[model samples]
Target chain A: MSRSTPLREVHETLGATLTDFAGWLMPLRYGSESAEHNAVRTAAGLFDLSHMGEIFVTGPQAGEALDHALVGNLSELVPGRARYTMICATGGGVLDDLIVYRLGSEEFLVVANASNYERVAAELTARGEGFQAEVDDRSDQYALIAVQGPRSQEILSSLTDADLAGLKYYAGLPGTVAGVQALIARTGYTGEDGFELFVAAADAVSLWQELAKAGDGYGLRPAGLSARDTLRLEAGMPLYGNELNAGLTPFDAGLGRVVRFDKPGDFVGRAALAPLKDVPPRRRLTGLVARGRRVPRHGYPVVLLTDGTVVGEVTSGAPSQSLGKPIAMAYVDTNLSEGLAVDIRGSHEPVDVVDLPFYRRSK
Target chain B: MSSIPEELSYTKEHEWVAGLDDGLTVTVGITAYAADSLGDVVYVQLPEVGGTIEAGDAVGEVESTKSVSDIYAPVTGEVVEVNQTVVDDPSLVNSDPYGEGWLFRVRIEGTPEDLLTSEEYVTVTSSEA
Candidate 1:
């Protein structure tokens, strides 16, 4: 059985196609996914991200506990800011990618993926045993809503007067939005200027309706997981099951910059990841642009056109509405650039190797 | 409630058979229910014209963003004509699934068995929903 979010009724009322995602029933799309994707690119789109887990770590040593449990140095993060970090096993394999926000001097909120939140909470509790921090799993109590896109600020400014102009990227603030209290964070996964409002579960519906009404004139649409997936794919963001997993480390995924070897304490994967930092991975993650209309899908083999040897596999793929072609992210032999073709179904369709991000919003 | 043409026969595989009463040539295309469930159709691979196929054989494929499904032949026949327009523009499968979205025309070789009527298909679809 899958758990339903607090906004399940709201989504159904709007005629959303709901699907089971990470043990939770969530909206897949409201109508045309391509139209929703375009709305986020040009205007703004509202998202129901309540399936994300919110784990709170509080006490005097909260930052210290996180530094020892995760890859990044959470103690270094100033208040009202968030950092995109990850948790790894002792063997240097990634456990889950996270966004840690420093709400106060002794309070920190760690947002984790829905599938891995329970394990993350357990691990945090066990790891913080000697420290003066307390870990609590509050995933059910919070409902997160994000307003993302180029016109996100304009849309949000109509609802809340909280210093939207002063809040920098990765910064968060506690303020009233549409007469309701929320932790409005200037963060988004779509590579757009957006805000993620974390409110109580009981207040999600009203908050959503308020934002929807405020954004009506701005072409704001309710985007679901389908559009969100395509938007993040075009932004070169790594998903947990697709790009990051227990078998691959941050270095293997080309995200070595997040690992802070200079931190004071020894983290969980410090020793294992320290040695592999200098050694290049066998296969590096790269982008693929299909030459034909056939969409390259997941688990498809990426091969060398010269000999049809399977060099790597596609991690995530989709028909990019922004690029007007099918694009995919795959792991190929390190430095193998030429003669690339994705084995689409049975036929080998030609694809061009491009950079990681297929699209970037102009700043 | 998807449209189930009373004149055409239906298959449990979500295909509709047109010209079945003519007893010589029948047109095959996925039902609207199948197309709606598949979401947006981005690519359609049609079978080669003038190729012999058996009943229940997977002839072609329909690729959507969320998933892909095989277009199966309803009866044993030789493919006489394939809809080139659907092959070029796959959105026709969602827009006009019963009309321009027809997959292929088959020169019937044997009797099609286990085919359902429009009423029977409506019951089949409603139960699944």
Candidate 2:
């Protein structure tokens, strides 16, 4: 049986089309994907992210423990601050990418994806030999809801006393939302101004209801996993299963900044990541936009114009909600960058190699 | 799923066939119910005008964000004309599902049974719940 989130009933009640995803029943949509995508872009949107995992690390030297398990320097985090970090195996492959929340001097919360919950917990617990922190997987006890878009602050600020404005990006604060004590983090997967509210499992439904009601006038519609994927893809963010997996390192995913080699202590993947810094692999992921309306699908082969030789395949492709055209992200050989050819049907068309992040939010 | 206009015949593949005054040409399009269920039609790949298709064979493809569905031929026929409007403005299917959204007109050669009535379709989709 697939695991159900606390808001499962709420989604069905709203006529959501549900599908099984990564061992969990997730909502695919309530109506049209185009309308839902526009809602998040032009207005506000709500999402039930209760399927995400929340783990806690608490002890006398929790920072020391996190510094060892993560590739980033956790010692630099002050209380109430948070940072995006990745957990790696001993060989330097990624275990998961998560947010490290410094709740207190010796307390921290690591928010991970739902599918990676068990793996993240087991790896962290097993790697706790030299550290003084206790690793506890508290995923079941908590629920997450994200209010995203430009007007997210105006809607969320109505119920919270935490002074949401003072919270910078990647910062977490203790606050009360919908009459329940919760943790509000100024972070989200969507490339919009939003907050990820962590509350007790039982309080999730009421909080979502309140957020939806309060945000209704602002065009806040409940979004499903389908729109979430489009938003993240437009933001040029990586998905765990699609982009980052256990076998791929942070460097391979164009996230080299997360790897902190300056720190004196050795991380799990430090030795393997050392040589990659100077000379990375030849294959790189690049974004493409089709000049015509022909949108490419996933797993479509990219070919070289000179010899019709297949070089790479599309990892993710969709009709861009923001770009208003067919955009794609594909893994291409580094030697084939700048100007490459993508096989749409039987014909190969030229594609320009721009920088990473096909779309950027205007200031 | 409106009246199915007593003048028109229904196909099990969810298309409505209107026998035109020119006996050999039959106007064909998907029903409103089918279009509504498809949500917003983004892109469609249609067969050439002279392409021959067998009964139950997929003559084209209709794609939305959530799904990519095959447009199966209702009867053994040759595609004589296609709506180019869908290629430019695919939303025509959602706005005017039964009219401007007609996928194509076919010069059917043979007639098959199993086509449901309007009342029968109402019973079929209502129970599809």
Candidate 3:
């Protein structure tokens, strides 16, 4: 049986198609997914991200514990800010990608993927055993709502006096939204600017209703996981199960910059990742745009157009609403660049090797 | 619930057949239930005009945003004509699956077998849903 989010009733009333995602019943879409995707690009869209796990770490040694348990210099992260980091196995294989928010001097919120949060919480508890920090999984007690897109700031301003303009990217602050206490974070997975409000589970429905009312004229639609996938793909962001896995390190995914070898103390994957830093990886994550309408999907073999020799594999793919073509992220051989084709089903569809970000939001 | 026309014949695969009584030629398209399940139609590959196809043969494909489904030939026949408008604008499949979204016209070689009546198709969709 799948767990239901606090906003499950509201989603049902909106006639959303609910599906089981990561052991939780989540909305796949309310209506046309393409329209929702377009709304996020042109106007704004609301997302129920309560399925994301929020693991709280507190005490005097919270920063130290995180620095040792995961990669990145979390101890140096300023309060009220967030860092996109990852936890890895001893062999440098990624356990999960995380966003750590520094709530205060001794408090930090580690947002994890739903599927891996329980294991991540256990890992953090075990890793912080010698330190003076405590790890608690508060995922079930919180509900997260995100308003993302061009007009997100305007829509969010109508309901909260949280100084939306002063809140820089990757920053969070405690504020009251629609008379409900929330941790208003200016962070989102979508490529556009947005605000993620973390509130108590009981206040979710009313907050969502207020936000929806405020965004009525701004063309805010209730977007689901389908649109979220396409939007993130176009932004060239990595999904944990698709891009990051236990078999590959950060360097293999072309995200070696996120690993801070210079940070003090020996992290979980420090030794294994240190040696691989200077050495070029065999397969580098690359982007591909389809020449034809056929989409290059996940697990599809990327082969050489010349002799059909397999060179790489697609990790994530979708028909891009922004690019108006099929786009994909694949880990291809570092030595090969051009003359690539993704073997889609029985036919090999030609593709061009492009830069990592298939689309970038204009500033 | 999706609309199932009483005048049309339906296949278990969620395809509807029309013009069955108007000579040997019949029009075929996916049902609205199938279209809603597909989310948004991005591309449509239709069987070639004048091409020979057999019943249950996978002749074309409909690609959606998240998944792809095969368009099976409903009746063993020669493809008389393909809908060029739907081929150019695949959104027609989601916007008008029963009307302008008709996939192809087939001149039947033999009577289509195992087709369900409107009432029977309703039961099939209800069970699946």
Output the number of the DockQ-best candidate.
Answer: 3
* Displacement of the residue A223 alpha carbon in candidate 1, Å: 1.3
For candidate 3, write residues A95-149 as lDDT tens digits.
Answer: 9999999999999999999999999999999999899999999999999999999
Least accurate 10 contiguous residues by lDDT in model 3 chain A: A354-363
Candidate 2, residue A304: how far the Cα is off, in Å: 2.0
Task: Please provide TM-scores, in order, for all candidate models, with all chains considered together.
Answer: 0.97, 0.91, 0.99
| Model 2 CA deviation exceeding 4 Å by range | A345-350, B1-24, B27-39, B113-129
Question: Mind giving the per-residue lDDT tens digits that candidate 3 earns over B20-120?
Answer: 98789999999999999999999999999989999999999999999999998888999999999999999999999999999999999877898889999
Model 2 lDDT per residue over A21-55, tens place: 88889887887777887888888889888888999
Instruction: After the best TM-score superposition of candidate 2, give how far the Cα of residue A217 lies from its true spot, in angstroms.
Output: 1.8
Alpha carbon lDDT at A182, candidate 2:
90
Order by lDDT, highest first: 3, 1, 2
Q: Sorted by DockQ, highest first, which candidate order results?
A: 3, 1, 2
Structure candidate 3, residue pairs in collision: none
Q: Which window of ten consecutive residues has the lowest lDDT sum in model 2 chain B? A: B1-10
Q: Which of 2 and 3 is ahead in TM-score? A: 3
Give the poorly placed runs of model 3, Cα more than 4 Å off.
none
